[model samples]
Target: MPEHSRQALSDYAVAHTTKPDSIFDDIARDAQTTPSAGMMSGRTVGYFLNTLVAITGAQRVLEIGTFVGYSALMMATALPEDGELITLDVSEEFTSIARKHWARHPDGHKIKLILGPATETLDTLEPQFDVVFIDADKDNYPEYYEKSLNLLSPKGIIVVDNVFQGGRVLQQDVPDDQRSASTRAVQRLNEIVQNDERVNNVMITERDGLLLIRRRDAHLA
Candidate 1:
């Protein structure tokens, strides 16, 4: 697509998509105060996650990253009254800010933030998550994907963010060794999901990239 055409469609999408509630707008603005504010999840990804929670009737959610809680709050808002979401992150600096925002939302009571490497923290939990969203360290995506499977419920779904690595996965001109770790890791993940017969997956072209997966026997697509 040409640059002007792309921008026009993007503008149309933005104009048609529902805006976040005023409270969420506040959280987004506060997220900008961080040095890595650009790392925050965009509106499209956030709304998609919220829809997933509602569609799955998910009572238990596990979030692998909690950058200022934009995504966490999105999912939390869609959860039922008795629903629970346990989000893992290693940065107290960011999660502290997340906590503040979560407190401002009514459904925020459903979220729990655990501070530690998710690789270690993931082991302590039971395999009961109805929905799992992974958006943490790029290099550790492979490890996270495996662990997420172990914790997933029979009818659960997995949503992965940044699967495209800003479209680096397709640069065949660059040798594997020379490419960045994130790019290489994302390539490997896409391959892993493609080859796995135990599940079915689709790569959504929204945002950076969103990979939605489910057990072959899962009720939802």
Candidate 2:
């Protein structure tokens, strides 16, 4: 792709994909008031996540980050009537906005928010979730991935957001010890997932990047 067309390509792709309904617009509008508004997962990832739930027929889902609930609601829409999603976040302030919007939709009942540090919250969760999404603090990516892997059901998929770390990992490789903490964790995650004999993976380059992984020989314990 030409340099000029790079951004245009992304716009074109998002335009062609399933457009989010007006409720998402409302959520986005509310989130815009915050400094970290940019962290809200946009329609590209949200739409893809929705589709993943639909196709996988996932009955239960786990999300490590719930930024204003954009992605959580997207996945919830694709779930069956009896399905459920459990989302974790540390901020009541940010998630207060999420709660307002979740209540606006009928699928809101499908979502349950756990307000606490994700690492601690992960320890309390039982395994066998059909899908686990990690999108929280970059410095803890490796730890999150390890715990998420164990929480995932056999044949379940783990979808990691921001794995590219805004193209930082694309630069010339550096010794792991020399990289910044956040960068090192993100890079190490990509490396570990790619080489792990226990799972198969693919990295999709769209809106940052998304890493999708699943066990090669799945067995839920």
Candidate 3:
């Protein structure tokens, strides 16, 4: 598809989707102006995450990355009154910005922001998350997947973001070693989820890419 056509379709999709409130709008504006704006999950993905939380009725959510807390805010709003969400991030600066917006929202108290290496933090968490969202460093995608699976409830769902890696995952030969490593990690994650017999998965092409995996069960069938 032509770039223009694709963008038009995306615009249409966003237009028809559930709109976010003013708080999310403000956070999005800040994220765009920030130096690490690209790290933030955009509005479309935010809405999708919100919808997942609603549809699954997820009481507990675990987010591997919380860049400025855009996705966290969205998911938190969709949760029930007593629902809880724990978001992990390594940067205090980014989480600080997130805390500002979260403090103003009514559901903000439901979110717990943890600052530090996600891998170490994941080790401390118990297996009770109903939904897990992984959007952290690309190089650790496989490790995140493993840890997320271990932390999930029996009927839990895991959402993996940036599976496309800005279309780099499709490239057979990436000359840059650093970029190659990141791309290879994403590729490996896709392969691992695809072949894992413990779960059933589907990859969606919505902005970048989102891989939704849930345990294979008779109830699901």
Candidate 4:
């Protein structure tokens, strides 16, 4: 095919692929807004999360960050009638909007939203989960991963979003500040996962990035 036509075809392919209804899109319809627009996870990442939920037949799911509940809604939609999802977020403002859309879905009742800082909220949970999704504060990536490991059952999956930190992980000259701290923390978590013996891992470059970790016995690895 010609160069321009080939480029056009590729663009079309990308656009025509399955796209999840994002919270941002919902906001556009409702004329609602948030500081970040809750545009964290992309369509590809959302679909991946949904597929994982369906594959594992996850009965219980824990989400660290419930930004507008986009990911939670996507996951809840895939859960069995009796399955449940516990989503935590500090932002009551955003969660309120998320609740609005979530309420519209028949399966929305499966989602239980907890408001408060995620770390504090997670501390109160029992050790029972089929899957846990970490997408909260980047600086706490390691903490979230460690906590999720304890919370997850054997064979359960722990999916971490934005592990790439917008490609800042590969950059040089990070200043000594919170931004630098978050970047450094994410780097440390990546190293931890790379050497972790308890989980099989794959880091995919979808949306920002996604780290899919499956907890299994050493023999299974």
RMSD per prediction, one decimal? 1.8, 1.9, 1.9, 4.1
lDDT of 3 by residue, 1-221 (tens): 88788889988988987778898888988787678998988778998888889998999999999989999999999999999999999988888889999999999999999888898999999778989999999899999999999999888899999999888888766555646788999998999999999989999998789999998872663
**Of 1 and 4, the candidate ranking higher by TM-score:** 1
Task: List runs of model 4 lying over 4 Å from the truth.
Answer: 1-16, 19-24, 27-32, 172-179, 218-221
Instruction: For model 4, state the Cα shift of residue 66 in Å.
Output: 0.5
Worst 10 residues of 3 by lDDT: 171-180
lDDT of 1 at 113: 93
Model 2: runs farther than 4 Å from truth? 1-3, 173-179, 219-221
**What tens digits encode model 2's per-residue C-alpha lDDT throughout 76-178?**
9999999999999999999999999999898999999999999999999988799888999988988899999998888899999998787788654677667
Q: Against the unseen true structure, what C-alpha lDDT does each candidate score?
A: 0.90, 0.91, 0.91, 0.80
Error of 3 at 131 (Å): 0.6
lDDT per residue for candidate 4 within 1-221, as digits (tens), equals 46577557545654766765555367344433555854556445666788899998999999999877777878888899999999988887778888998888787899999999877788899878888999988888999999899888777889988888877877556665645787898888988998998878999865567888877583453
| Model 3 regions lying over 4 Å from their true place | 173-179, 218-221
Which structure is stronger by lDDT: 1 or 4? 1
For candidate 1, the per-residue lDDT at 28 reads 80
